[model samples]
Target: MVTPRLRHPVRRIGDRDIDFSRRLAVMAIVNRTPDSFYDRGATFALEAAVASGRAAFEAGADVVDVGGVKFAPGPPVPVAEEIDRVVPVVRALAPFGPVSVDTFQPEVARAAIDAGAAVINDTTGVHDPRIADVVADSDATLVVAHSLAAPRTQLPLPHYDDVVAEVRDFLEHRVAVAREHGVPAERIIVDPGHDLNKNTRHSLELTRRLGEFADIGLPMLVALSNKDFIGEALGRDRDQRLHGSLAAAVFCATQGARMVRVHNVRETVDALRMVEAILGWREPAYLLHNMRSEGNE
Candidate 1:
């Protein structure tokens, strides 16, 4: 039998002393782009995007990741265009809760930070030195995601002597780069970049080996919601992958993932609560009260 993994704590956005443990945090995805892979044309207007963010929070999301461009196997937009698309959305959501800007451009990162974004979720893994400077200058948490190929390029057929080991090495180098840029270790989060350049087999292997990343001493955020791998595994289309996506979320929690970025907030949250219960973590007091016996003998 596989042994239960020991959990590690990770600091929240503004609270240095407080760490999120036991319960897995859910990050709702708010795609402002017209051509996002899954939620294409869902959030074209700034007001609509803000409303979506609010709704996601109501649905139990701990954070909202707002992105302007779709990195779905296509050429990247110009930096100026990307910044223009994302800045207003970031500014709108900043006051509501913690906002994370999903981009690999340094200028976009700088603009999003200036516009009140609290976190930088760069898919490039900080390969650009300027990105490091932007995060160092701004007091924002950084999510270093592992991606093998540029977003513009077609994902090269999955090539890896060993996918897990290569990912660990890439993540370690990224952590070192973040430290060299003067960013605190606590401010760093790592993502395995599911589907960024992976096939079904590689993605499953990464998920199975998720615990290995915990040794890096930072919180691991798994982004496996509605990904192609899930569809491939369940033999379903994008819209029908909800059940598979929830299964992946629960598995990630069991494997020690601290954060999950997903589209279906309510479903994922409900599934994770069940996983928490199975792990013997206490539920919220309100839930307990609801479970009380109405008529005791």
Candidate 2:
């Protein structure tokens, strides 16, 4: 007979202790580019992009990550051009809720922070020194995502002696860098960068073993929404991976992800609530009904 594992109690973020036990936070992706792999041409217009951000917030997203460049296998945009593309959107969306700027360039990071973005979602993990200075000078939280190689180079074939250990090490190194730059330890979040430089197997292993990164002691953000690995796993295309994306979100929440960046917010939120119910991490309706019956008695 197999014993059921006990669910770990959800904890607060940073020393600030922000309670996240109510539900898994949803981060909606608002791509402000014409070349994004999944949502290309979907958010090209500024009005459409802002509307998408507003709609995502209405759909129960806790945060919105706005990006200017595609970052898919393509030519890189210049720093000035990237900033020009994202700052306006960030300025427009800052009043809604927590806004995150998705860029690795320091100039863009600084401009976005000035434009009222509360978080810096750096895909390159502060590879550029100026990015460190930008975060150090501001109150913005930094999300250091792990990408093995540049997207232009075909993802380096997912070579890893141990995927979990290498990813943990990379994140730990990034944390140390942020600390050295006067960015408080609690303000840092780590992401495994699913599908960024990883193949299907690497992404799967990372998803299954996400619990390992909890030892790093910072909030974990998982972006497995409609990624190609899900398509590969389900033998479906990007648009058809909705169910798979929700499944991955539930798995991430079970494995201790604090925030899930997804394109489909409502479905992911519902799936995570169900997972929480099954793990006894959340109060079950039947239990509540029984309590009401006993009260009547």
Candidate 3:
């Protein structure tokens, strides 16, 4: 039970074979939604979104998660419009490296895949099994994130008897659905859907017990960047939540989370690198502190 929780040593997302045994992946967010709670549509324009992806890749982001729809309640974006919003960014960024589309609609997932997205990041936990079928038909990865609300709908005062147990169980059920749809085991990832229809206490409990998710036997992706829970935890606004976010991210990574979805790509990459070094999974870039025969001090 104390062994590495991830069943697969390598998870092939997009064109990369992520070594889950040693590295923590950073899934950088580049939202194309004008009303995104994080960036406030900073990358809503096609060019801005593409530029953001490129910048994230340069900053050491392992995967670029391109989202066209805002997570909070919003006006409905027609399927075609959503496709129009994400497909181009997916196409532009796909060549650079692994590109994930944050969507739940089967049609949008199919379109994004056709446009070169390698991961269908369904934060809805694949409420519609057709999304699983779409992923199955392709060689793409699927992220089944646990969330109770329908896409763009609100779940007022969401409650759970035990958030961790319920979230883990939800993910297990969703993974089974994906498997039933022929999605290979190595291509499936799970996210606990922090702050998505969950209150801060629930999110914190999920974070505290995130290790329990290892029972699911798959790589875990924690999308806890700049979330309301972090803000509520430390009383910081979106832009000010970086420190709290890093703390949560590092804790989860140390506890065996394989991927962290975040807006602060470079910071996350740097922080996770330090964690990896401390965990013996990575080496220091330069060992200059005490290499000399005599101490400089």
Provide TM-scores for the models. 0.91, 0.87, 0.96
Report RMSD (Å) for each prediction in the order shown.
2.7, 4.3, 1.7
Best by TM-score: 3
Deviation of model 1 at 204, angstroms: 0.7
Better of 1 and 3 by lDDT: 3
Q: Give the CA lDDT, 0 to 100, for residue 158 in model 2.
A: 62
Q: What ranking of all candidate models by lDDT puts the best one first?
A: 3, 1, 2
Task: Identify the superior model by TM-score, candidate 1 or candidate 2.
Answer: 1
Model 2, 1-297: lDDT tens digits are 112122322432212233344456778999998878788779978998999999998887778999898666678788898888889888888887778889988888999999988888988777775787888898788889998665344565668899889988988897788778888765777898898778899899999888877666677889999999999999999799999998888778878787899998788767776776776667865555355666587
Alpha carbon deviation, residue 104, candidate 2 (Å) = 0.2
Model 1 residue runs over 4 Å out of place are: 1-10, 14-18, 284-297
Off by over 4 Å in 2: 1-18, 21-23, 151-153, 276-297
Instruction: State candidate 2's TM-score.
Output: 0.87
Assess candidate 3 and give its lDDT.
Answer: 0.90
Q: What is the C-alpha lDDT of each candidate?
A: 0.82, 0.79, 0.90
**Cα shift from native, residue 243, model 1 (Å):** 0.5
* lDDT of candidate 3 over 217-294, digit per residue (tens): 888899999999999999998889999999999999877788999999999999999988987889899898768776
Mind giving the per-residue lDDT tens digits that candidate 1 earns over 185-222? 87888998888888999999999888777667777889
